[model samples]
Target chain A: MNILVCVKQVPDTNEIKIDPDTNTLIRDGVPSIVNPFDGYALEAAARIKDNAPDTKIVVLSMGPQQAETALCECLAIAADKAYLVTDRAFGGSDTLATSYILSKAIEKVEELENEKFDAVFCGKQAIDGDTAQVGPELAEHLGYPQVTCALEVKSEADGLHVYREAEDGKEVIGVKTPCLITFTKPSFDPRFPTIKRKIAARKAKIAQLTAAELTSIDPAHAGLKGSPTKVKRTYVPPRKEAGVVVKEETVEASAHKLFDLLSKAHVI
Target chain B: MPNYLKVTPEIIAELEKAAPGRVVTGADVNPDYSKDEMPIYGVRMPDVSIDAQSTEEVSAIMKICYEHDIPVTTRGAGTGLVGGCTPICGGVVICTMRMNRILSYDLENFAVTVQPGVLLQQLAEDALKHGCMYPPDPGEKMATLGGNVATNAGGMRAVKYGCTRDYVRAMTVVLPNGEITRFGGTVSKTSSGYSLVNLMIGSEGTLGIITELTLKLIPAPQATVSLMAPFEDLAACISVVPKFFMKHYQPQALEFFEKEILVSSEQYLGKQVFPRKIEGTDIGAYLLITFDGNSMEELDPIVESASEMLLEEGALDVLVADTPPKLKDIWAARSSFLEGIEEQTKLLDECDVVVPVNKIAPYVEFVDEAKKNYDFEVKYFGHAGDGNLHIYECSTDMDREEFKKQVREFLDSIYRKTMEFGGQISGEHGIGLGKVHYLEEAAGSVNMGLMLGIKKVFDPKLILNPGKVCMKL
Candidate 1:
């Protein structure tokens, strides 16, 4: 069975600094990184490949020219191949447009490979935006079975058994082949790429496909025009002002004052 | 020439449906998730990021990825000195920020259970509330518990309290197979088969993802005194460290700073640490010694004896201060040394090399002489009691690229010298991405083989933070 993994390149949010003047993100000098959650997806896929050596694992990413770095990382992790969907027309695409374009790109890839994807895996969400909508949207568009917030996965001769996170506990679900999955954090700790694989990934060339190259696509279904939501303003939240400090002469007095403050704040 | 991995619309749709509200895609990906504190390297951002609050959430995410075969990287506060936290591979980055809750604190057992994302400073403050202290202070106040465990970080207090590994009583780790297993426990000691807890301590997030940790705490020092002793010559200061140990002064902390480091530190703290400047006198080094005990009466004799010993051995005046604020000021200067060194250099790379206590003098002399041969200026300071020294090097007149090359050579030479004296390549900072190559040399062939074998046993898929610590898999 052929498996596909969707990965994306994002900015390392920990290193992000906001442009105070404009209240917007400062992209310059900020490093790009692979969405950390994708490692679990890759690890999961690699496990499946290990369990069945004949299985083929493919990685897909959508981003600018620099996005190939993410694919290279996947290759280092033993992904058999990688594909990049990059086009100026795809710029400023939102989750809706991204899912649409990626769906098309994956379709084109299937046709080119002359095979069908048995399953697709994705990290539950990206850290920067925190808006986890693409995976479900992609699953919806493809009309395939999907399991979200997955923590555990076991493959059987019939299909796959997955453990997903619920509100208070976990829910076990089984899906047949050709399903999609969105991983939850701490699912399985992602594996590190071996040295041999890293060397191969470093030299692996990523295939790039522009919007036009992704088959007959409508111009209206690309870029900003295809995006349904637009960000209007961004600003940093104000710093919390220090509260009044009540001083007391003795430890008992201080404790009473602390109790009073807690009472006033209704904390106890 | 393109090596392409396939993604399908069916998979994307399934992922979206599964995670109704958390997934991020396309231009929604922000830039801040890309890099770490390492100054030289540029950013490499993740395509998607996730904030997981529970083990189930993490496991669910892993199950999906396992089916499709995606790469993932884990991140904490991103205060890493090396590139270990950078998702050099752009996939999913699981941010532990939301998982920062202190789960439990048992004062009786002297143990605290905390989520991996909890900050060290927060833990220290919380521990202090109960008249206890978490002694593993790694300088960076914002570093997370998980990051500390990942790196097995040590700091000035390591001379007394030991590093993170010493205090880690238990851990909840997520394996590559998405299994959340508990290792070790609240029990003080264990003789388990593999000691997976110890193995994971300095694994650099390769073996497993640490979700929660139970750390041991100690009673706070009751009465503390700090002293600053100025030496007329560098040899005297270096020679006095081992003497303190031999005399059994039992100092909680013993640190040494050269003239350059002291002056820079003073400037950084914006306060005069030394009573008077000994200018043009070629004063080589200054030592800061601190003693802590249960009572002032108990500490007074020890402080007096240490002072008398220093005076007798070095013939230099030793100033002792017991006032809280005054002692705090002196410590502030010492802790601010890293920033001061950064302020004084155009570019700097630090070597956290540790040597045998007796070899401290020889190692310092060797590094001092080697400085003249190198293309950069070198400054030395650190926890002298533990023989762990931070030797920082920066460009003198060379360009950036040349300076980096020379810095590598200088560090290589120092590592060689350290090994000859039975020393470690890193005393506090674990073998993150920066020290991977050196770790191989330091661990030698036999140890490296064992480490690799263990890595395979714990992480068969090699999916945990790749390219860190033990070379890939």
Candidate 2:
């Protein structure tokens, strides 16, 4: 079985600084990291291959050249191959255009490998954009059934078994082969990359695809020109409420008080 | 023993008059003020706890205590492991934590002036904001700079950047006579007079109270990388540390510990980052090394060579943690080992002895062998690069008296062995009241007499932190 994991590089939120005058992120000295959820998505894919040695994993990302660092990390962690779909024409793409480009690149990747992927995995949401439309939209474009908030995935006889997070609790659902799965954060971090793998990853050449090479896409339906949505402006949201912490005699008392308060508001 | 004056209402009133609302007495005092982190030594509540806010306030408190013939123990955040801030004499414990303030920065001289009560974590963070780094990185980040200076505290980075004493450029100290005097200066070279600054650095609060400090800072390193190497046994693990220096890896920190201790930390933090086994073999010990340089490009070759060296020396495998989050997790686990042990053990005693780096493996092996005859469980870990070992004797099942007796014997043996190896009894933890006997044994009568002579010159009344360090109370 072969899998393709999608990853993205975003500014590390912990170290993020905002420009006081411009009200925009000060990215000058801020470090970039592989979106944490995407790392977990890759970890989910890696774990499946860990239990089943024959499973192959490939990782793809769409960004500028610096995004290759994220893909290299993906390879070091266990990706069998890496692809960077970067082109100047793909600039200013929104969720719809980004998903369209990714779906087209997924097809191109399939043709290059000459093998159909058994599953597609992605982070449920990129932390920077917080727009969760891409994964489900990619699945729509690929015409494959998809599951969101996949806590774990296991390979079965004819399909894949996925444990997805639900409102009440986890709900286990089985999906057939050639499906797509989006992942949230896992309990543990992704495994550490071995020395040999890290050294090899540092030197590995990533396959880059351009808009011109992906001939199936017409310029009319790609990049900024294709997207109809526009973000007029954005400003940091003002913090309106600070959380209230209850001081009680014991934890049980605190919990009871919290439950009573919540039930009074008909939330429980 | 010297007769110590008791705290009276009159004396407490005088202290309150000196420091205003910052003085607390009797039942009003918090229990934490009675002891330091290592409570096993002993605990005694001071009659009056004064939160001195400035050098003049400290001077006023000291003058009152001096006139009353009361012993005064200056305390910081009370994070000391050697009872250096315990206030065992029990007259007055002057806590300087509230005096914590960053005074100024001399950018030209690369020095920052701060109140003694300013914590290590605060100074380290504030310095980084100015694009400078304070080199002394002690494990207890919450410990105040005053306490660190008094103990001459050393930590993980001591192997590379040196210790607290190396960073202290000048200080304003209030002596027992209520005289505030300045020591050294913000000069790169000082040879004009007696080194009073160096003397007060590790005097353990016996001579004077550190009021303010001018600490030297260096440019911050651009990148840092940590690598962990697991070995089949500790001998193989520790023996490879000295080789890093010989091969010139210039590791910022080199620490080695057994798998069981890591398991304890894992339980405490509810986080698992280290492996218990590798390649189907149980990991006996791991050597954690950190490298910092101008950039990752500069550290890359150093990390590669160090990893290769460890693998050649019977390592299971070398793992790299160049990313910030991964490195932070590894160090968080390392820094919390003391808390982890404290939570699990009912009775605990620790000995921080620093020997020659080359003797670390043999010393570790000797401790392992010596534990067979003792009833308590022995857990040991230390800086492999600096040769300072924190070997703990712990027991949850033994009676308190029995544990105390056995631990005494155990400490006697360890301290004796430490001296035989030309090692110091207390590496970073000073000779507070708890370990004065061991310090006496290690320093010998003649050397101890010199220290006592020096102590008397500064504190003639012997009222400042009596019964600690070289002073015979």
Candidate 3:
């Protein structure tokens, strides 16, 4: 079986700083990382490959040249092949246009490799934009079924068994081959890359695809011109004040104090 | 033994006058004030405890204690491993936790003056906000900066940046007689009179109480990368430590631990960050190293060459942790080693001994051989770069008293061997009540006499943290 995992490089949110005057993100010294949820998505694919050694995992990303670093990381972890779909025409694309371009790029990738991907994996949402529309939209564009908020995935003789997070708990669903899955955080963290794999990843050839090469993606329906939404402005949210800590000699006393305080405040 | 007056209601009234609403007596005093992290040494509740908020308050409290001839124990967060902050004499415990504050910053001199009660973690984080760093990174982040200075704490970064003593530029201390004085200053270099600041450091609260501190800070590093190298066994892993220094790798931190300890730490953390097997070979030990610099361009070649050298020196594989989360995962496990050991063991005792860098392998081997003669399980890890090893002897099956007796014998053997190897019995932990005998044995009478004399001069009544450090009582 072959899988294609989509990843994105975004500034580490914990280290993010904002320019007070411009009310915009200060990206100068901030470090970029593979979106954490995308790492979980790749780990989900890697675990499947762990069970079936013959499975080939390919990593795909859409961004500027620096996005290749995220792809290389995926390659080092488990990916067998890497592709960066970077083009000036794809700049400023919103969720709708991104899913459309990615759907077209998937076809191009299939033709280039001469193999159909058995499954497409993606993070449920990119942390930076957090639109969460791309994966489901991509599945709709490709006319394939998809599972979102997937906590885990297992490959069996029947098909892919996906345990998806629900409002109450988790619900298991079986999807056929050629399906798409967008993963959330699982119970386990992704494994660290070994030195040999890290060295090899630095030397791995990352195939770059441009707008012209993806023939199915029309120039009119790509980039900023095709996007329906635009962010007018951005600003840092105000930080909340530190909470009060109640400590008594015993747990019962502490609880009583908390209950009394909440009742006095009309919160309980 | 030194005679000391008990804390009477009159003394409590005097303390309340100095630091109103902060004094507690009898059952109202916090039980934690009776001991530090290590209760194995001994514990005794103070007759009175006061949370001092300033140098004046500490001085006033000391004046009352001094005139009444009460033994005063100064405590911080009470996170010390060797009972350094334990109020074992049942007099008065003057705690500095309430004095938590960052006093000032002299950017021109690259110094930040802070209240000793401020936590190490608080200062470390606050320094980063100003593009500066407090370099002393002891494992116990919640420990007070005052306690760190009092113990002259040396941490993982001691390999590169030295210890808390290296960072301390100045401090305000209250003497036993309630005299407030300043030591050192914000100046970078000093050729002034007797180095009183140096003397007060690592005194374990026996000399005076540290109320305020001015510490040196450096510009934060632009980039950092950590490497984990697994070897066939501890000997092979540790054999590569000196080679890194010989090769001028200048690692920010260098640590080595056996797989068994790593397993216990991972189990404690509920996460496995390091691989136990690589290429079908079970890894018996690992060396965790870190390098920091202005840019990756400068560190890349160093990392590459170091990786090559480690592999050549019997390392099975070297793994890189360049990202923040990866670094946190590895370091969190490394820092929790003591807590992990403590969680599973009913009785525990450890020694933080510093030997010559070259003597680490042989000393560890000697320890391994010696532990076989005892029933308790032995586990160890250390800053391989500086030759400071934290060796712990623990047991779950033995009776408390039996474990204590046997461990005492075991430690006696260990410290004797340490002295023979020309090593110090206490590295960063300091000679608190727990290791006084070993310290006396290690330092001998002549050196011990000088230390005791200095204590007598600084604290003539021997009323400050009585029965601690060089004190025989």
Candidate 4:
């Protein structure tokens, strides 16, 4: 089986600082990491490879040259190959334009590797934009069945059974081959890379695909000029007030005080 | 033995006048104040306990206690493993927990003045905000800095940055006779007189009560990374430790542990970090190492060379954790070993012994062999780079007194062997009531006599923290 995972490199939000004056992110010294959801997507693909050694895992990303670091991280984990789809023409692309360009790059990558991926995996949403449109839009662009918010996946005789995290509870859904699955966080964290793999990954040759090489891509539907959505404003949300600790000499008294406070506030 | 006066109502009134509403007696006193983390040694409720908040209050209380000839015990967060803070004598217990405060930071001197009651974790985090670091990272983060100083705790990072004694440049102490004095200073070096600061450190509260401290700090490392190397067995894992130093690799922290301890830690944490098996071979032990530098560019080559060296030294594989989440996962398990062991065992006794780095493998092997003759289970781990092992003996089925008796015999053999290896009985944990005999046995009569003489000069009546360290009364 051949699986392709889509990843994005974003500044670590925990370390992200916001400029109080202009309300812009101070990304100068902030470290960049693989989007955590996308890491889960890559781990899902790696889990398949763990069960079936013959499975080939390929990781693809559409970002700047620095994004090769993220791709190499995926390679160190489990990916057999990595490709960065980067070009000046693909800069500042919105979710719609990104999915359109990724659709074309997938075809170019398939032709270059001479293997059609049986499954395509992606993070449910990149933490930076968080629009959550790329995965479903890419599925439509590729004309494949899609599953979102996947918590777990297992390969079966004819298809993959995905445990989807729904609003109510988990729902197990089976989709046939040649499907797309977008994973969210799971109960367990991804594994750390081995030193040997890290050394090899640092030297791995990451293939690149430019807009000129992706001839199938429509120049009209790529990059910032072709994006439909416009982000008018962005600002950090105001922090909520810290809650008051209700304590009394006894537990029952504390409970009573909490109840009275909640009742007065019309929350009970 | 000295006959100490009990805390009468008159004494309580004097203590109340010294510290005001902070004094408590009878059932009002918390039972935890009677013992430290190690209750196996013994516990005794003090007749009166005071939550002292300042050096003045401590001095006044000490003056009253001295006038009345009442034995006094000084305590901090009570996180001591050797019962260093336990109130063994029934007199007055002056706790410094409420004096918690970070007084100031001197950027010029690279020093921070803090109350002795401040916790290790508090100072560790606060220093990072100022782009500085308090490098003595003992395993117990919640322990009070005063307790750490009193015990002279040596932790994982001691291999690179030294221990609590190295960081304590100055301190304000209340003498046993109610006199207030300063020991050492913020100056980097001192050759003027006898180093009272060095003597007060590791005294286990036997000499005087620590009220304030000025600790040394260093610039925080810009980049840090940890490597986990799994080997076939513990001996094989530890044999490569000296080679690291010989090769001139100075890791900030170097630790080694057995697979069973790791398993219990992981189970306690409900997370699996290190792989149990790699390529059809079972991993018997792991060496968790950390390296830091000015930048990743400076550390990359070191990591690469160290990884290669580890594999060459028969490591099954080396795993790298450069990210925050990854490092937390690995270290959280390493730090939770004691909690994991305590959660499963009904009774426990431990010793932290330091030997020559080259003797770690043989010492551990000796312990493994010695434990077989005893009834309890022995679990061990250590700072492999510095040769300080935290060996725990635990059991769930033995009677309390029987367990104590057997562990006493067991530790005697171990400490005798440690002396034969020219090692100290306690590494970071001080010699409280639990290990005083072993300390006397390890440090011969001549050395013990000098320590006792020093104790007498600082505490003539032996009224402060009696039955600890070198003092028996």
**Chain B TM-score for each model?**
0.92, 0.98, 0.99, 0.99
Model 2, position B343, has a per-residue lDDT of 83
Per-residue lDDT tens digits of candidate 2, residues B1-473?
A: 66777888888888888989888888888788899888888898887888888899999999998998998888999988778777777888888899999999998889999998899999999999898999998889999999999999999999998989999999999999999999989999888879999999999999899999999999989899899888989998988877988888888999989988888988888888887778689999989999999998898788888888888999998888877677888898899888889989998889899999888877777888778888999998898889999998888899988888888888898788888888888889888877888988888899999999999899988999888888755
**Can you tell me the DockQ of model 3?**
0.56
- iRMSD for each candidate structure, in the order shown: 24.2, 1.1, 1.5, 1.2
lDDT of each residue in B385-421, candidate 3, tens digit only: 9999999988999988988998999899988888889
Q: Which model scores highest in lDDT? A: 4
lDDT (Cα, 0-100) at B96 in candidate 4: 90
Q: What is the lDDT of residue A181 in candidate 4?
A: 96
Model 1 interface CAPRI class: incorrect
Kindly report which residue stretches of model 4 are placed more than 4 angstroms away from their true locations once superposed: A22-24, A167-169, A232-268
Clashing pairs in 2: B2-B473
| Candidates sorted on DockQ, descending | 4, 2, 3, 1
Q: What's the lDDT for residue B247 in model 4? A: 84
Better of 2 and 3 by TM-score: 2
- Residue-wise lDDT of candidate 1 within A1-268, one digit each (tens)? 7889999888877568898788888988676767877767787888778778998999999888998977987886669999999988999988988888888888988988899999989889887776788888889878889999887677888799888889999898989978999987752335444334655666788888886688666768778998888888767766588898777889899999999999999999
How high is the TM-score of chain A in model 2? 0.90
**Candidate 2, which segments miss by more than 4 Å at Cα?**
A238-268
**Local accuracy of candidate 4 as per-residue lDDT tens digits, A40-75:** 998898888889999999999999999999998888
